[model samples]
Structures are given as structure tokens and as C-alpha cells.
Target: MKRIYLLLTTFSLLLLQACNSFFDQMPDDQLTLDLVFQSKQYSEEFLAHAYSYVRDEADRKGGVPFDPLSDDFDVPYSESPAYPLNIGNWNAASGNYNFWQDYYRGIRQATYFILHIDENRELQGMAGGPQLIKQYKAEARFLRAFFYFNLLRQYGPVILIGDEIIESDLDGNDPKMNLPRTPYDACVDYIVSELDLAATDLPLHFTAQSERDYGRATKIACMAVKSRLLLYAASPQFNGNTEYVDVVNPDGTPLFNTQYNATKWERAAKAAKDLIDLDILGLYKVAGDDGNIDPYRSYRDIFLTPWNNEVLFARKSSDLGWPYEKHTAPRPIGGWPSYSITQQLVDAYETASGKRIDEPGTDYVENGFSQADGTYTEAGTYMMYVNREPRFYVTVLYNGSYYPSRVNGDQRMEFFRTGSSGRDGARDYPHTGYIVGKNISPNSDVRNSQFISRPYVLYRYAEVLLSYVEALNESSPGHPDIATYLNAIRERAGLPGVPQSLGQSEMRERIRHERRIELAIENLRWSDTRRWKIADQTDGGEFWGMNTGAGTSLHDPAYYQRTVFERRVFRKEYYLFPIPQSEMDRNSNLVQNPGW
Candidate 1:
């Protein structure tokens, strides 16, 4: 039995050249192209190296990670991307920290792998030679599709470069050299078609009877991508988006269709339903945790358990050391105190019985210190925090909330003015009087250097369930499966089932709200707001935080009040990120995104 890469890829087993400026340029000091594939290790090493291009959601050194980018949270630092983006200071020149070049480089690498893999004499000579080679081809193709989907998700329509290399410059002056942007729908079809071909060669799941190939791409992975891609294409952002009507190719060919396609939603729903039908994945439930479902354990363990059943696709390695906790937790316990939870997101969670506070005939409060339902004991605590959803307790760490940190000698988090981890002690304390609780494991002890590595999930069963519910409601209008899937998530979160009387319009809001709370800090909020065409509404407004501006003292109730920290302004141009000007200068066939 061959040892699989702990990260699901052997890329990290050996360090490779970081730069891919000229992917085709041969290294003068290394193995020759002919000799490289002669050995299985060298060949597998090259293929494994390409896996690093996959996105990392928990990379905080990349500057405040994804959680703070949306209105859900705010970081205290003014130098980070979130701050500049929040204040409307990002421009094409500055904001364009684009991935177009790097992704194309990865695609080129995958193409190279597919083209040269047949030269592997070792693999070709095996008893399973033909089957192994076929799997390799499928892997390369799936990776190529994955790269393209990443580009599509971020930059929208992009040129679909096939598996052939051209002997020409990539600069703007050569019209014959540059590939024009493929139409949005065409790009979607090409990606799906590629996955369809690759899936025939991939397995559903690795059988326990076999000791090899645990983390490789599978039939289910391809289906999930197809579902997510179709979901995006069918969304309001890409489906019949009139904003791109004037945005077309230089030859006057339309890239984004102006007419809405209702069938696309049906296709999305069907695709997601297929993945759900597989039955291998589901909302992760903790067995023997009592009927009162430990929502915290159920939710937190999604990212903690090694290759847990909930994870569909993830980075199965812990490359960084306790970074998630360090970035989100407070200061007294070796935390950065940077990532802070916002009042907006705090208000989104419903009561334990699944009722929104602002809804008619409900007893929930958004403000003031009243101890609404005796969920916990604290003096003059915010009434808004009591009797809220279990997810709210699992997520937000308010001033009075008790949270134990294994890294800090099992010490709990303290967030008031005079508390150990309060604003009075540190200059970089949380901007809002709250911290996020989802990403860190309760057993992780950074203080003792007892580190644990678990897969960082990019796609999970719960997301698929939610996506299916959202699409089903949109397509068939109040479909019953919508309630079935949505209620599954709610029940796991220790909440009652939703009212069956909820119609499509009402269900839509319910679905969105559920996603907002459930998927918070998982890098979905930014895209969700954009795809739902609610960025302008959700993004533009005053951002609130507990008073860091003019609080008199710990005795000041004004210090406990929600104060306006920063006013965020989002523009229409922000709907699509700007293609870096360097790429535009290099490839004239490229057009900048709207208002860039």
C-alpha cells in the first residue's frame, strides 16, 4: 500500500519552484522532460505540485481572511484589504490583486500533466497500466475544470483555453495570439462537459477494501462542482444580467445573455439533487450526544474532524498553526483580536424555537441589557443575546458570554472593558465587542503546543443541502423538498422546523438568512451578497461596533451601546472585480469588468 499525501496531495512532500512565469520553460538544473516521467515519484511530484493552487480560506496572513470582507464582521486594522474595501478606497490599480495569471498558470500545468503523462514507462508497464493512465488523465482534466470554475466564480466570463499550446506571445498587440473571453454560458457548458467526461473515470468514493487513492477527485466531487457552477450561472448575477449587455467581445459577440433562463435553475436543482441522492453525505450528526443535539459540537466539528462525513471537498492538511484561533480570539489568550463579529450578523440568529425577534408575535430583543431568557448568568447583559439560536451561542462571543479556550490554559474569553481580554488592555482589541467561535476547536491547546491538523472544508453536505433547497424553491415555487432540506439543517442546529405555510417569497428570505448565519466566516457571505444582487443594499450603510470611539469608561452604558464605527460604501462596479491592467495591457482581447 502506497502512503497517500497527508494533505490529499503529495505537493507538500517536496518543495517546487514557486514561480510559474513561463510554465513551459524547462529548468536547467533539474530532471530533463524525458527523464522526469521515467520515474513514478518525479511524475507524481509534478502533478501533486499543482494542487497548491487551490484556494485556502483560513489564510489570515493574506490579510484578514474572508470573514471580515462582508458586513458580517469588521477587523480593527486600517491597513488590511477589508478596511480599504469597506471604505470604498479600492480601485483597479490597487484592488486588482487578481488571480487570472496564476490560475491560467495552474491550467497550463494541468494541461502539461495530461499531455506528458503517457510518457510514464513505469505506470505504462504495470498490470493495471491502462487503468492507471486513464485515472491520471481524468485527474488532470478534473483539475483543469476546477481551475476554470475558480476563475469563473471570481472574475465571471473568461477565455476557455483548450488543451493545446500556441507558439505566440500573450501581449495585447497580437490579435491572433490572444484568446477572446468565452461567453458566460459557453464557459459554464465547457466546465460541466469536462466534469461529465472526467466523472466516468473517477470513483464515487474510495472503497475500504482498497488501501490506495483516498483523497483523489471522485464522481461526487465532479457532480458537486456541476451543481455549484449551474447554481451561479442560474443566479441573478449571471443569468440574464442586463449590466453586461454593453460588455461584449471586440468582435461584437455577446458574452452574457440579457434574457433570463428559468430552466437553468431547474438544471441547478436537478444537479444538486443528484449529489444529495448519492446518500454518502449528509448534515453531520454527533451520535449519542443526547436528543438535545449539541449544536456547538455538531457545527464546530465540521471543520475539526479528520475527513468528516460532512466534507465533500477540502484541504486535508493543517499547514498553519492555530491561526484560526489566533486571529479570531481575544488578546489575553495569544490572539490577534483582529476578527470581530458585527451586530448585523448577531441579529440574524433566531430564538431557540426558530422565531426571529423582529417577526410579529415574538419576544426577542436586539438591544439593551435585559437578560431575555436566562440562557446564561451575567449582570445587566444584553437582552438580545438571551434565548437566541444555539448557533448564535456556537458563533458569537459577546462581552458576557462564557467561552473556554484550550490554548489559554482552558481559560474563558472575557470581553468587557475591565476584563482580562478587554479593550482597555490592548490597542488592537476587537473592533466590535465580539469574536467568532466556529473555526477553533475546543480541545486545541496552542499554549501546550498540542497541534491538530484537520481538513479545511471548501464544500460540505450542509451547503449542498441548502443550495438544493434554495434552487428547488426558486424553480418549482414552494416545492416540498425545499422544506425537507431546510428543516434538516434547522433540526441539526437545535431549532424547530419552519412553518409549512411559508411560501416561496417568504422561504427565499428564510433560506438566505439561514445561509448567512450557518455559513458565517466560511468565505460565502461576499459571494452570496454579490450573486443575490443585494450587495448595494447589504454593503452600503453605517457599520456598528461597541463603542471604541468615545466610551467614557467601563461604568458607561454608552460603552456597551452599538456605535457607528465606520460607514461602508459599495459601488455597482464592485459587483465584478476588476481585471488587473497588466493583463489588459498584455491581452488586448480582454475587456475590463464593468466600471473598473
Candidate 2:
């Protein structure tokens, strides 16, 4: 399988490199079908390449502004004037197009392998042949499903190109190629069926010599992916859009598919439950003897440490590879200023006692600390308002908290007030009154920087648990399991469990708050907002910065005092990105999504 994969990969690369004018030219080194799948190892190698394609498209490193543009995160431009206010537009087209191409390329490769793999299986002599073939086919299906999920999220109701599509009379220059969109239901059905098939042959977990394949696709991963996709599909944006109803069948029958179905949500919950029943990968708890061990502390560490029992699937980073640390770390140390935690996000944390600081009579101050001596003053500090959510202090950096100083000889949390002069020779001094991160390391040694090779976490067990809870609550409101699941997350965060007496709406609010605080700045915020239909509430605004001085511009806001930018709203149309104009031109059958 490995040999087949390498040969196909080499062919793909050579084919991709040759210009359109050279399409007729065949590579002399190309392997014929007879030579390609002679062994199972060759087929396995091809599957590995399919997995690699998924990883390459998703992992946005090298300070490359790809991932953020996918609505997972945002790059606040506090400097560039050309694209100053609309930073979201950066990499919007370029990145989406690249992802589209990469995913389709992977799908095409998997289809090719599936088409030919069975023909060469006659060489297999005995015992393990059928099982191995089933497993390989399952892996290919999973890969295909994974690619389709990406397409569905980015471009709704995409043309479902399968091996059959390739063999159809509509292959080249056929007007049917310009056929209208496939029904979204059709797309979901295709995805769900693929996942179902993949799950049949995939192992629950690997052991012994197969331990090296721990991160590969598994039965649980397929189910988890299906659950997540279904949840999104049933959510407000896609499922709630009435205009998308009346989708046509091949026989031209109208399908009223726009209404949100409670059954779909129930199906999602059931899917998640199926994985939990498998009992292989469970939520990771903190280890050690500390009586007050907080499970939330393990959240950041999981990304830093891959193959963590909690990580279901992650994009593996090789030594000396790409990641986000270099861009977000303090410049003098390393890292560009990419994504920063907003004050709104900062205020969402709860007190250790489980009361939100903004609650009535809570004695919380916008700029005052609960403690005296003012060392960790809340005044003008966003971090101060929310004093002690375990997840809060664990994730955010504020005044007086020690950050590993790259510029100074010793680690220090420099508190720079407005008009404060630098005692030491620190450049970019006192820019922002508060440094807004605590998760990233600030080591000065370039070789040891955390930016490179930090594994990109695609899915974690914590998220899976939370998803199960959320779907269950949405489908069956006020279930006791709601509080149980909600409190499990809270307990990990060193807070008391949620009260069972709270109303369903109140409980929902609390769980959402927990999710916001727990998952902040982990690249999940934007999608969460979209799915919840709260993009306007979360993103529309005059996003503020600290007012440092008179010389400061919109690009460089004063980090010392409060400054606001007008109209930083995220419109509803932003929920789904517009399909690239180039793609639309090629496939006339594709319709531009509404408001694109």
C-alpha cells in the first residue's frame, strides 16, 4: 500500500506541476495499474497520502494567515492601513480556494484507490487479506467523508463528485456539468453513509505493533465527526434558513428541507452517545497528587502534547514545522500579533464560587480589584473584572502575572501605565496596558520557540463530551444529565457544579458561558458564534483597544487607555464564505449562496 501511495503521490505532483498546455504529456516514471497495486503495502501508502492531504490543508502555520480566515480565528490588524478595518478579508478567497482544491484532490485520490484496489487483491493468499482489504476501504471512506465535511461547511450543497461522477457522460464539456446544486440533504446523507461504512471495519483502538497508527482514523473518530457535522447541519444557520427549502430531486420533486428538525438533533445526540458507549477514548482528567488538581489546566497542555489520551485526532507536526506561537508571542521574544482575546471574552469568566462578576450586587468593578494593595488592580485591566474562574486565570494574562520575559533578563509581568517611561530598554514598551495571553511560552531562544511544531488539535475528548451535553440538552431540555455534564466541565475548572434548580434557559446560558471561557482563543469562537446564530452579538462592534497616547492611529491603538474602532460588526452573510469566483466560472451548475 505504501508503494502504491508513493507512486500515485509522485504522479499527482508531476501532473499538478505541468501546466494545462502540457496536459497531454505523460511522465515516463509513471507507474501503470499493473505495477501500482501489486501489494497491500502499496495501497496502505496511498491511504497515508490521503490522510496527509487532510493534514496539510488544515494546518495553517508559518505565520501564514490561512487558518484565521476560515472563521476559526481573526487577525486584528493594529498596523496595516491598506486593509486596516477589514482584516477578515485577508486570505478569505485564497485560503478557501486552496482548501477546496486540496480536499477535492484528496477525495479524487481516494476514489482512484478504491476503484483499483479490489482488482489487485487476487495476489493476497490467505488469513488477513479480506480483513485488511475491508480496513483499507474503510479508511478511504473515512478520508472521503472528512473531505466532504470540509466542503459542506465552506460551500453548502456542493456537487458530490464520486467515482460515479467521474465515469458519467457529464465528465467534460457536458452542460450537465453546470447542473444546479445538490440538495443539502443529499450531501448530509452521503456523508453519513460514508461514515457508517467507515465505522464498520475501523478498529475501536489499535494495540501492539499497530500502536504507531494510534492517531489514524478509527470507529470512534468517524462517529464523532458525524455527530459534529450533524449538529452543525441541524443548527440555526443551515437548518433554520427557510429560503433553502424546495430543493429539487433528480426526478424534479420539491423537497421541503429548510425547517430545523428536532429529530436531527436527537440523531446527533445518539451518534455522540454511540461513541461514548464504545468506551475507548474518554475525557482526559489531570493526573498527580495535588488535591486541588484542576482538569481545565490540561486544556492548553493537550495542544502542546499530542497523542494525549484525550486527543481523538490531531494534525501531526514534524520537528521544525509551522504553528501559531511565533505570530502571537510578544514580538521582542518572537511571534507576530495575530489573534488576541477580547475584553468581552475576558468578562465571561465566573468567580470561583460560580457567580458571574457582572451579576447584580456582585461587588465587581469595571476597573477595581476585589483585593487590596492594587498589585493585581482591576482598574483599566480587562482581566481584573473576572477574578477567579479556574479556566480564566489559566488561559488569560493580565497585570502582575509573571510571563516568561524574552526581552528582560528575568521573567517579569511589566505593568505599564499611561505615560509611563521604560525603566529598562524595552522596545514596543507600554503599547498595550495589559498583555492578553498566558498560554504561549515567551522563551527568547529562537530554536526553542513554541511557535514551531505545536500539534494542531482537530478534536479533543473534552469537546466531544461538551458536544454530547449540548446536543442532549437541546434535544431533551432539563435532563439531569445536563447538570451532570455541565458540572463535570465546571468541576474540572475548580468551580462548584451547576444548580439543578436552575431553569432550562438559565442552564443553557451557563453552559454556553462555560464553553466560551473554556474554549476561548482556541480557534473555536467564530464557528460557535455562527452555529448559535449570535455572530452579530459577538462580532458586531467598535472593537476597543487601550488608549496609550495622542500619536496612536487606528492601526496602532493606544493599549494604555480605552479606544474604539467603529463598525467592527460580523454580518450574518459572514457565516458562510462566498464560493470563489473562479470556481463559479468553471462550474456553471453552481449557484452563489444567498447574500454572497
Among the numbered candidates, top TM-score falls to: 1
Kindly report which residue stretches of model 2 are placed more than 4 angstroms away from their true locations once superposed.
Answer: 1-29, 56-73, 77-98, 121-123, 165-172, 206-209, 243-256, 287-290, 318-321, 368-386, 404-410, 413-454, 548-560
Q: How does model 2 fare in lDDT?
A: 0.57
TM per prediction: 0.90, 0.80
lDDT by residue (366-439, candidate 1, tens digit) is 56676333644354666767778878887888766655565465455556566656667676677677787776
Count clashing residue pairs per candidate: 1, 22
CA lDDT of 491 in candidate 1?
84
Q: What does candidate 1 score on TM?
A: 0.90
**Candidate 2 accuracy as TM-score:** 0.80
- Alpha-carbon local distance difference test for all models: 0.73, 0.57
Writing each residue's lDDT as its tens digit, candidate 2 over 443-531 gives: 33433553333445566666766777777788888778778877876776667887877876787777777777766655566567777
